[model samples]
Target: MIKLQNVEKVYRTSSIETLALNNINLDVKKKEFISIMGPSGCGKSTLLNIMGLLDAPSKGQIEIDGSKVENYNDKDLAHLRNQKLGFIFQSFHLINDLSVIDNVEIPLLYRSSTAKQRRDLAQEALEKVGLSNRMKHFPKQLSGGQKQRVAIARAIVGKPEIILADEPTGNLDSVMGNEILGILQKLNEDGATIVMVTHDDAMAKKTHRLVRLFDGTQVM
Candidate 1:
């Protein structure tokens, strides 16, 4: 489980100050699926990044499982990011030059696994997303939905406990969006905690809880 207490994010330049998140408190239970909804500049992605430990909060604390993140060093943060969390972005961040399976294996490269282990895990992850047949394909050769599935496969290849997805269905058609959402739901059912940022109300409704934000503050 992940917990954020009185979290606030502020970005400052020489003369400008912007508040990205304001006094946010959230408790994500184990295996729970939650969706975050907000306008274009309402800090949905900012909150997610703080939760994923990719960014530090300016005025509050982050607790993962039970340890306070403030006490963790850079090396500790890297370990948590690599071994405890998985990420899926709205834009598929696949390397165009790598094959589908190789793209999925990117995360494993940070760990100390053998080549065979990486390939087997990537194979299983691609199979989970129904992309087993396309492992040999390239990113440019696949459809948008297929590309996103490959992204999902890459995210889960590490078997991390928490999955942080940012507008995962934003680039696809309704049918493809539904397919991607169904895959996320199945992953939740199979015991991965998910926190998703979405603009679509229908997609937000499918999660167990919906947290709404406005002007960088939790409104609902």
Candidate 2:
């Protein structure tokens, strides 16, 4: 469902150019569960950002579900990203001021869905993440795992085709991390495409395929 060919990402300043990704080539199929493993500063998160359309590659092509994203206008890219990609981050990225349900509803608020419909979808998403009872709670009131689940709920509320998770279990203990991994496995089984970046080898092994990177290049 996603393809990257010779993708190169360079971060530039007035006097320095840092290469974040170098000639990344990958093809992720629909409903596939893929794990990206690498050391710190190895460009794993950079790759995920590019794949999710949050950042553009410097000199390569990115195709999502057959559309060449490099040529897409900002609005088109935003539309496609909202329609096709979901993201879960290590930091959870929840708005502390918003309630769990409100956080989950934020993504759908941009779409044409009515209030009731958005609420219904958000509730369903919360239920999927085992956070239905905590919908009215704020992020600060929840544990780290619960907060991450809320983030996952927000990610899936729109039913995007692909989920890009970066260090999804980074802040959780082993038990809580396992719980989150189980949810992701179930989602994959139910036909959701997932590409997750993790430092844990055990977590990486849980996915169907693994890709390792070194110095911004895919080495395995």
Could you tell me which 10 consecutive residues in candidate 2 have the lowest summed lDDT? 65-74
Residues 116-212 of candidate 2: C-alpha lDDT, one tens digit per residue: 9999999999999999999899999999999999999999999998999999999999999999999999989988999999988999999999999
- How does model 2 fare in lDDT? 0.94
lDDT of 1 by residue, 88-177 (tens): 998999999999999999999999999999999999999999999999999999999999999999999999999999999999998999
Residue 28 miss distance in model 2 (angstroms): 0.3
Residue pairs that clash (backbone atoms under 3 angstroms), model 2: none
TM-score of each: 0.99, 0.99
Query: Candidate 1: lDDT over CA atoms?
Result: 0.95
What do the candidate models score in CA lDDT, each in turn?
A: 0.95, 0.94
Which residue segments of model 1 deviate by more than 4 Å? none
